[model samples]
Target: MNRLAALLLDRRLVAPDLLATGPIPDLRGPVPASWQGLSRTVSVSEGLIALEADLLELGCALSAPLRRRLAELDAWELTIAGRHIVGAMRSKVGGHVDHVPLFRGFPESVPEDAFDFYVRRVFTVLLQEPEQPCVLCGKVATVHPVSPCAHLVCRACWDGSDFSACPICHRRIDPDDPFLLVSAPDAEDDTARDLVPHPRLRLLSLCEDPWAAAEKCVRELLSGQAALRPEDLESVAAFVDTCAPRSARWLPDVIPSREGKATALAALLARAPETLPDLLDRHVDTATDVLRLLNAAMDGDAGLRRARPIAARCPAGSAGRCWTA
Candidate 1:
């Protein structure tokens, strides 16, 4: 039996009685060459989907667009040998040209919009949820983010002290990088609180070397205390690659001041720096451009140039800039 038929049969969508009906007038479209069963058939200019009763019911979960198309269609027309299906037309023409061809589920090339929509949705959901337990320490925290190296760490595994670098994925994060504290549920304001900059807590100053802090954050991600699913981790790693290069230097040091700042930043990427300094040089320009855009919306004004969210970048050598950097 065809996979679709098997799927339908398993779901109990079609009855055995219908199966023996000898190719009922299922005017779906040109049936697949492989379909075979009782002999009777119909040939419509268009093709139709032939699914078991349960399989048709399962279609309810499909995206709104696909479901709508399926819902508007009429019955599936069986092919003579059962190898093909004839689809019914919403509007029938007098001539044979109205017949539609059956298509393989897989298309040679998908529309750009459709492909992009799928890719974005797939990665977005993957990053948010994984099918398997985290690969790092194996703890099961529901809210884990991936490190640059693609390890899934739990919050408990990363209590913010000691060893840097993800144990499983091996992405490096500085111990001193500022981490955003989750807002307390009772707190009225939802603004994120930085772990650094506590007046009495001198050890956690904003001036703490950012690279070291980022390394620490990466370590926490790999420990599995904040566990992320393996697939989710991979997706986050993928998201990092598509993003443009970001500045690694101290973000607070480079907020843009006036007009023409965006143009200046585009020029800075050409200059190279060694180690952290190089990272910082790249960071300066990226940071300037971002701040200007954000501030642009202060009075309900629209931003002229929107900066892509910084969370898309590799979590290595940079973390102090906040989640949306």
Candidate 2:
């Protein structure tokens, strides 16, 4: 297994040459028979710009939003592959690169956002009566009960015993659950391991403009179908405060969540004091929005949830200059 872990995949597995040439990915190697006359390097030199589109055409197993992020790149270099592509054969030229691990496969039955689906699933399972409503669809139905925990599932929605834990309750079942067997010698008693699947590396590179690179990384976190996680919201606010306090494009045109709006708005206010009136007019939809923004500025979670709101110097007036709160 260690040997396998150390093994690098053939760079040809998803060759840039064949991918850019055709409408589909195929068993054909990099260069086609017709293109045999052209310089191989010249032909593929268009370089992986259509990468995301090609992957989508190939029916890649990645989730929807992830596909866009995985495609974000400025330039491609073979030398830098080792940094982001795990077990990648390093090239002569290199810089900072980071890897995003992709699970081999998981439930793709629904088009829901994966993280949002998991959280809603956990809540849906915990709060409802076992047999009253289907855990996934939330409809009252004739449900089949999984053993021991008796978490009712719509069998149509779930494949039985495919889970390491009760699909509904997220707890251990008896020894006979098809996913595990105490009788097997190699059954290590691991419950949480199910969440951590064997991952494949997706290579990511930064954009040349450092601000654009920072914006893209931060934007990916906010572009998800779900609201920013409480912890993640705090981290984003802190990061933006340090990085892009004044760039309006650093955030989306509309942020739907309350915590996200407040945390971000406050960060801008603290970092760039001139950020107020115009930003508030653009973002604040209601009185409550202003209150949350002010609350974060005035009395926050000790600046953990946002940047410490700062005071801007008052402009000189005919009357006199005085500091405003």
lDDT of 1 by residue, 93-198 (tens): 2243323223221122112222222223223323334332333444334423333322234566564357576443234655675132222322342111211111
Scanning candidate 2 in windows of ten residues, the lowest lDDT window is: 101-110
TM-score of each: 0.18, 0.33
Error of 2 at 7 (Å): 30
Model 1 weakest lDDT span, ten residues long: 196-205
Number of clashing pairs per prediction, in order: 64, 1
Deviating ranges (above 4 Å) for candidate 2: 1-199, 202-204, 218-225, 298-325
* Candidate 2 C-alpha error for residue 311, in Å: 14
lDDT value, residue 95 of candidate 2 = 26
lDDT of 2 at 316: 28
Q: Where does model 1 exceed 4 Å of error?
A: 1-61, 66-225, 243-325
Across residues 99-167, which tens digit of lDDT does each residue of candidate 2 receive? 111111111111123222232322233233223345455454545445544334566666564566666
